[model samples]
Structure formats: structure tokens, C-alpha cells
Target chain A: MNSFFQYFADIFNGVKSLLTGMKVTGRYFFSPWEIVTQQYPENRKTLKMYDRFKGEVIMPHTANNEHRCTGCGICETNCPNGSIEIIQDKIDMPDGKKKRIIDKHIYHLSMCTFCGLCIKTCPSDALAWGQEFEHAVFDRTKLTKILNKPGSSILKDISE
Target chain B: MKEVINLPVKNIEEEEYHINMGPQHPSTHGVLRLVVSLQGEIVKSLKPHCGYIHRGIEKMCEKDTYPQIIHLTDRMDYLSAHINNHAVCLLVEKALEVEVPERVKYIRTIVDELNRIASHQLWWCSFGMDMGGLTCFFYGLRDREKILDIFEESFGSRLLHSYYTPGGLMMDIHPDFQKNVKVFIKYFRKKIKDYDDLLSGNVIMQLRTKGVGVISKEDAISFGMTGPTGRGSGFSCDVRKHHPYGVYEKVQFNEIVRTEGDTLARYLNRMDEMRESMNIIEQLIDNIPAGDYTAKMKAVIKLPAGEYFQRVESARGELGVYVVSDGNKTPFRMKFRTPSFSNLSTLDYVSRGCKIADLVAIGASMDYVIPDIDR
Candidate 1:
């Protein structure tokens, strides 16, 4: 008689635990407001991230078309993936001496991990993050960009 | 005379046996090896051996560029890749003295939360499998896949996305990401019931898990267990709530806790945490502040020489990255205080004298991923 009562008590406890768990889940299921989910793309205008969140590398161009990049190759040397490459040209100086001029600063957006090593390694304050995040393109070649456009003069203040 | 001779029988003595439970056991969850000494069914002693998956991440950081090292961080805790990326980004941003945009911070918070949910989902699935419930593993993975789908859309990689950079995120949230996340949460919230029905209230599961592997609150603190492991033991140490990085300060969510400090308590705490993460995601989806995702900073970022330590609440626990910079692109010395390392160390203390089957329960309660511990 005692063993039978023990079996019945065990069944009662099991049922009680089951119902208690169902109640907890049931509360979350019924309340739509309690569901914390965001629909993206269709809601791009509402999407938010932190202001200082690091995304990609970009160079800020001034209204005068002056850029701070001096072709120092600090960013190139510091890049872990070899994503940034700098090509230099020797320009004839007024004193009949040739000075090393930055011909190209190639940035491979495809290979870039966005680790910010190159940016952090730059001695010159020329490299800055541009806010354009939509860099997706059909041609992979488009991703390897020259931060400083050809014939664009270096910013005078960037040298210091 | 024959009966008297038959009565002279000898007794057999039980032998102490040593069972090595991995560097490669399916239930060890990584490359963790536990040398378990047992006499019959009860474990006499357990010694946890680590360093199997250690790639020497700290040593590797010295050779790789700051950006290159971010890839290394991805391999440390492969499950919560974004959180690791976020830690690296936060440290570099602090060192560089760069200001990130408001929009980027909000996005970071959302992604971080999403990653947390995904990591916990994997944890639940694996924990269930460890405890002898195979169905729960499938259920947990089914939900985890939805989150992985969202990650694939935005970052172009599911498991190891090097998405978070120093100044902001790698790309804008994918056009369909918001809708997918919403659907995922709705489906997952309903699925939680199915999980509870399948495993939580099972008599054998409850009997095996509850009141087993109990750790006192003081021991939990002394051992430095974090995330759900410590939270199960009633420690309120969530970096998201305490430090309030990115947009976590603005979003509302509760830090899930349980007072029992037992295996069942840890399991329940993780279940509650998954729901809380879903709550935070729901609140922020509609209100994501719009602006430039990346801040306008110099093309080249240079940091002044100083040591910086940034802590983020990873899915596992408090992930602290300590970086010393010598005004160079490469970090002078980088140290990562991974939560799994401390959490894994507590297993020996907790598993003593328990049955061999209960050792898996105790190890599962710790919720350790081997790479996280080894790295």
C-alpha cells in the first residue's frame, strides 16, 4: 500500500513540473511584444550600430582635392594580409634632385580583414576612415582602389 | 568431506582503474583530456589536461599585424567570433583614440547579441548531447542554424566572420538581415517549448542533473568562473550590463541568474539567458538609430604608447583582452583572459567522488569549448 502511494506521488510531482515548465514557455509564446526580433534590409533606415564601430578603410578627400597620404607605406607594411600596397615615383625636384613621390596607394578591399593594423601603423595622420560602407561590386578589380587619385596633390599639413 | 572442500572459496577484490576521457572524446567538447581515476562506478580523482589546441595566440600576435591578428582571434573562440573581433576592435580603438559613429555602435550591439544567442544555442545543443539527450541536440542546432543564416548574409561567412573592424563593422547589415532575425526569434521562441517538453522535465534527466555537481557561491567566485557557469552559481558578472559597451547601455535586458550552483541550475540559467538575449534583440530591432556606420578618421591610424584592457561579455563569459602598444602597428604584448580557461579548471574540484556518468554532467555544466580554454 505504501509503495503504491509512492508511485502515485511521483506521478503527481512529474505532472506538476511539466505544467510549470509549460507555463513559462507559454508566456513567451503568446506575448508578441515580448519577442525581441528585428527585420533587416526592409528596415535599413532603422538599423543602428555604434558610432565608433570599425567597418572598413576609406580615405577622406578634402574639397581642395588634397589627401594626407604621403605614400609612407606604413599602412602597407603593417597590413597582415598585404591588402595595402604603395607604389612610389621619383619626381624631379627644383634643385635637380629626385624626391620619392607616391604614385599609387592600392587598397585591396577584398583581402582587407579590417583589423585596422595599417591604419594604426601609419605615422602620418593622412589615413582616415571614410563612411561609405556599401563597397560591394560585381568586378573584384573595383575593390582594389587607389585612395589618392592620380594628379591629386598631397595635403601640406599632412607631412608633419 | 566434499562439501567442506567446496566451502573453501576465495573472494575477489575490486581494482582501481584509470580511464583517460580525451584529448579526443566527443563529450569533452574540444581537445580537453581528463585523466579520471575510478574505483568501480565512483570517480576517485580527475585531472584535466589542456594545451592540446593551443596555437599560442598570444605569441602569434607579436608577429602578425594588428589586422592580421584579428583572424587569429577568430580561431580562439570560433563559436563567438564576433565577440572576439569586437574585443580586438575595442582595444585598438581605445589605443588609437578614434571616435566611432553612433550607428556603428548600435549595429555592434545587435550583432554581439545575435552572436551571443548563437553561441548559447550551440552550448545548449552540445550540453544536451553530453547529458544523453540526442533529440535536444538536433532541436538546439535547428535554432542555431537560423542565426548562422543571418551571419552568412551580413558578414559573408557563417562560422568565422572577421566582421568587426577597429572603427566599426565590416559591412552594413544585409538588406534581408533584419527580417530574417525577426523570423528566427519568433520561430526559436516557440521551439523553446518543444525543448522543455523533450528534455527539461524528463524524470531521468532531472534526477541525473539536479542536486548533482553543486558548487558553493564562494568557490565559484574564487575559481573565476564566468558567463552561465558563474551565473548558475549566482554571480552577477555580465560585462554587457556592467561595463555597457557599444549600445548595450541603451537596450534593456536582464542578466539571468540561478542560486543553486548545481548542474540543473546552470542548465536553466542558460535557457533563461537565451530568452533574455531574444528580448534585447526584439527591443532594438525597430529602434536602430540611423547615421554613418563608420566614423571619418585619418586614413592611417596611429596609437600613442599605452596599455589598454577591454572586456566584453562573450557568450561564454567575460572575455578580457589586454594589449600593450609600443606606438607600433603590432601589439607589444597581447593577453587574452578567456573564460573557458577558468571554468574548465573548476571541473576537477566539482567532479570528485561523483559517478563516471556524472563526470560528463559536471563537465557539461561548465560549458567549456576546448579552443577557448587552450587559446
Candidate 2:
């Protein structure tokens, strides 16, 4: 007789427990304000990434088109993957000495792992993480970018 | 026989059959393939075949510098990425004999506990889903997002942040880190009670998990199971408790253990652990000291010629990092004694007599992240 009562008690307890679980779901169901999902494309206009988001690498040039990179190639060496290549050209200085200048600072976005090693190890703080995350392109060649603006020269005070 | 008639006899009930559970199955989580032999519905034996997602991380470590190896460790156990990175950082610090600042120690411990809670949250949701409760998935991820936001706001990347360097943190945490974490702790505390209601006390969850996939304490130790899986079997194997590192010694938190050694016990252990993690975070968040985030070190780090081993209690289990350095920038050989590899070894032993459906629950309870196993 006790076994029969215990069986019924078990069923009753199980149903009650399940209902307790459902109560949570039901509460959230009725409350639309509790929703946490952000409609991605719809809210793109107002979306802002965090200040420290490691989106991609970029070389910041001053308004005068002078960059801090001296073509030392420390970033190229520090990068785990061969993503950065600094093309150098020798220029005859006014003092009759040949000085090496950066012709093009090529950055391969496809090969970059976004590890931030290049930026961390940069002595001159030449490289910075850009907020532009949309790197998708139809052609693979588009990912290979020249970081320095056209005909940009090195910052005068930064050069030793 | 009396009519001298020949008849084909088949003993289907006694016959054992085999079925492949994974390599693509949802329940397997990642690329883990389990060849399970069954006699009808009951699983006779299970053989977990790993290496499907192996990226040759160990071999890759041989060539990469110590700093470069930090990112690779993130891929091993992506769920416990912080803890994995912590293990390597601890190992390197021990070798280099650099005393990290008190601030760094406090922050590392707080972040490690936070990572543990996030990992448990993910496990809880997936475990529920494995048991056919889809709602748990959404609830778990929803709460987990709060923790990921904390990681992203400070560490930059959400999933695989190699935030910990050898000497200390990659950079000092964001100004709002402490405030944000405190808010999350307060918010999650109220919601955790809901977790108990939704899954822990549910009759179906109890019925499906209790007395299932049981492993004795002795068997658990023998199988080299650590973390919550071993704790479920009443094994006091928390690396944080036994061999405390960083600021873990200063903090106070109980190592949750259960003697039941069953799926329910493991589930409960992780649930209790999440609460403990919040307690840990609460203890350190307010008392974070003012000091340099990183210790002064040379640009190039070279460990003296020797073999070194360091173990840390990750979200899953004790993650052991063994390194042999020939006094170079790169390690001569690196071997990771990952928790999931040893934990997965015991699957066939524990789930022998369980129903095939119960296998999913057992695997979920074990919480063996596949990349950790393969790596």
C-alpha cells in the first residue's frame, strides 16, 4: 500500500519539477524586453566595436603623410606568419650619404593570424589595430595591401 | 529434425553489433569518433578514436618561439583558452624565475575563475541539449555572453585570447573591468538559482543521469581522470587545492567533490563549481593591488638548459605543460598532458552496461573537448 502511494507521489513530484522549469521559460516568453539577441544587419549602423578589439593591422600615417616606420622590418621578423614585407630603396641624402627608405610596407591580410605580435613588438608603435573588420573581397589580391600612403615619407623626428 | 528439414538459426538477442557514433555526429561535439559495440540498446563497449582534428600543435610548438606558442595553446582547449594560456605562462615564469607583480597574480586568478565559470556554463547548456533540453542551450549561452563580454572588453578577443604573457598580462586590464565583473557576479547569482530549477532539480534530468556512467574512485584515479569528472568519484584531485599557484593560495574556495561517481554527480560538481568560481572572483576583485602589470624582462627570453613541468587546474582538469629547453628561444620539445585525453580514455570502461542514449549523457558529463584530446 505504501509502494502505491510512493509511485503516485513520484509522478506528482516529477510533474511539479517540470512545471517549475517551464515557469522560467514562460516568464521570459511573455517578457519581450528580456530578449538578448542583437539583429546583426539591422543594427549595423549603430554597432560599435570595443576600443581594444584586434580587428586587423594598420600603419597610421600623419596628416602630412609621414609614417613612423623606418623600414627596420622588426614587425616582419616578429610576425609568426610571413604576413608583413617591407620593401626598401636606397636614397642619396643631401649630405652625400645613401640612406635606406621604405618603398612600400606590404601587409597580407589573408596570411595574418591577428595575433597582435607585430603591434606589440613594434619599437616605434608604427603598427596599430584598425577597426575595419570587413576584409572580404572577390579577388584574393585585394587582401595584399600597401600600408603607407602613396609617396609617404618617414616622420623627420622619428628617424635617427 | 524429425522431418529431416534444414533451418537457418539466428541468435539476434545474444549478438553484439557495432555503430559509429561520431566524427560528424552532433553529440560527439567535435570530430571525435566513437566505435560503440552494443547488444541491442545496451552499450557493450566504446572505443574513442581521436586525432580527427589534430593540427600538429606539439610539432608546431617545436619550431615556434615560446611567445608564439601561447596562441597555439588557445586552440587546444578553446573553451578553457585562458587556463591553457595560464599553464604555459606559469611554466615559462617558473623557468625564467621572474616574479610577476602582485596585481598580475590577482588578475590572473580572477580571470582564471571567470574562465572556469564560462566553461561550466557552456558545458551545462550542451549537457542539457545532449539530454534533449534545447532551452538550456539558449539560457547557458545567454549567461555566458556576459562573461565573454568581460573578456572581449579587456582582452580584445572573445574566444581565443592569448592575454597572458610569460612574465605577466599582455596589458593592464580595462578601467571598467572590476566594475563590470562585479555586476556580472551579482546578476549571475540570481540567475544561477534558475539553473537549479531548470535542470538540476528536474525529474527527467535526475532520471536520465542518476546511477548512470558510474566510475569508482579507484577506477577514476587509474584512468587519470581529473577535474570535475574525477571529483564526482570522490577524488580530491584539484590542482589548485593540492598545488596552488598564482594567487590561488591566498583565496578561499572549496574543491567540490561527490562520492556518487555517476553522471549526476559530475553534473552537480560542475554546478557547485560555478558558484565557487563566483566566490573566488568576489574575493579578489575588490582587493586587486596597485603594481606593474608585467615584470621587467629582456626582449628575448631564453630558458636555461633543463626540463620543466607545470600543471594548473583548468576548467576541465589539470593541464600539464612539460617543456625541454636547450637554452634557446624555442623549446626543444613540448608535451602537453591535456586533461581531456585522459578523461576520454575511461569512456569505454564506464559506459559498458549503459543504454546507447545514455552514452550521449555520459560523454556530455565527461566534458572532453576534442581539440584538447587530439592535441
Scored by DockQ, the top model is 2
Q: Give the whole-model CA lDDT for all candidates, comma-separated.
A: 0.81, 0.93
Docking class for model 1 is incorrect
Query: Candidate 1 on B225-269: residue-level lDDT in tens?
Result: 899889889888888888888888887788888889999999898
**Over 4 Å off, model 2:** B1-11
lDDT of model 2 at residue A98? 95
TM-score of each model, paired residue for residue: 0.74, 0.97
lDDT of 2 by residue, B142-229 (tens): 9999999999899888999889888988889999999999999999999999999999999999999999999999999999999999
The TM-score between candidate 2 and the true structure equals 0.97
Local lDDT at B4 for model 2: 78
Q: What's the lDDT for residue B113 in model 1?
A: 83
Model 2 lDDT at residue B128: 90
Native contacts, share recovered per candidate:
0.16, 0.78
Q: Which 10 residues in a row give candidate 1 chain A its minimum summed lDDT?
A: A47-56
